[model samples]
Target: MKREKLNEMKMKFRALSSNEGFARIVTTAFIMPYSPTVEELADIKTAVSEAVTNAIVHGYRSNGDKYVSLTAVMYSDGSLTVSISDKGCGIPDIHKAMEPLFTTDAENERTGMGFSIMETFTDKLRVVSRVGEGTRVTMTKRLSVFSK
Candidate 1:
């Protein structure tokens, strides 16, 4: 589906644990004007949380200085694309990392289902990572209109 883009907002913030909630709230508020369904809204929010959490807990994995950036764009087709990026240690094996029960920090109570959950909730989920560079998670979801 192709539609004209409406608006876009991108921001970079400190990769603090506290900012996870901030990501979710801003995502919800940003897409509110599109009148997304309750389910769609929840799905987007969950996806954002997982991506941001992964960057903070897995990507950086240390108490140091780093920034996580989030970019969101709204299309005329009622679809949104969100890209979450981190300049922390990148995943060595993206395929292995995306497995249902894979976690580098199991001792930290990580569920290891972040990627799977994101895929389930979004129309498309893509991850690109380099050993020394960083990782970027991009997701897109089409919001269906209410037909009541």
Candidate 2:
């Protein structure tokens, strides 16, 4: 079936802890209208937060000099796709990194559950990265709120 017109938005923010909250807020604002319920909005927001946190904490190694980019596109079929990306030290082993509770940093008490949480919240999750290049996380979900 043909999809509806897509609504798109893009943003770039410093890879800093403070921007994690901003990422969540921007993601929620972008996807809330398409979400079926407030719970879905919350889920997506948390997912985005995880993605941003990973970029700051892992990708950029808490280096505020780098930037994280976020993009959201809303499809006519009521599905929304959001992508969070950063140009920094890419994940060495995507499969290992995706493993639940497997963190590279034990000193920081990181659970290493960002990818896991993103997968659970959205209908689709994809990761594209290259060591020494960067990482991009894309998540898609069909929202019910826009049906009516």
Candidate 3:
């Protein structure tokens, strides 16, 4: 069955490392009424952090002038969908990029596990990108313990 969207939020911000935490905090606040379990909250926050960090660090390469957009939707079925996008250098190979420990920024000691962690924590993960354009990562999770 299709789930109706209960609420949504969209925000665009400079692709600064500091905004990663801001994104997570806003996301958490958005879902507070849902009463998600501690584990679920942690999972969502971690996944958001990874995606936002990737946009700032890898997508924009810390240039900070570019923008990253975050969109979140809450569904009637106790599910949340969050998408983070950046207008920066896109991934050349998404398949390889999603591979565990496969990082393009080894020089910066990046673990290359951002996608992996996001996948592990979310119920669904989708990534779209163009080589010279940008990348968008969307993740969803069902909040089984949420208050209806």
TM-scores for all candidates: the values are: 0.95, 0.94, 0.96
Better of 2 and 3 by TM-score: 3
Cα shift from native, residue 82, model 3 (Å): 0.2
Best by TM-score: 3
Q: Which lDDT tens digits does candidate 3 get at residues 1-148?
A: 6789999999999988889899999999999898888999999999999999999998999988889999999998888999999989999999999999999889999998999999999999999999889999999999986544
Summarize candidate 2's per-residue lDDT along 24-116 as a digit string, tens digits.
888777766654587788888888998899989999999998999999989988888889999989998999999999899879999888889
Total colliding residue pairs, candidate 1: 1
Query: Predictions ranked by lDDT, top down?
Result: 3, 1, 2
Location of the lowest summed lDDT over 10 successive residues in candidate 3:
139-148
Would you list the clashing residue pairs of candidate 1? 4-76
Candidate 1 accuracy as lDDT: 0.92
Q: How many residue pairs clash in each candidate?
A: 1, 2, 0
- By summed lDDT, the worst window of 10 consecutive residues in model 2 runs over 27-36
Give the per-residue lDDT digits (tens) of candidate 1, residues 30-128: 999989989999999999999999998888885448899999999887779999999989999999999998998888889899999999999999999
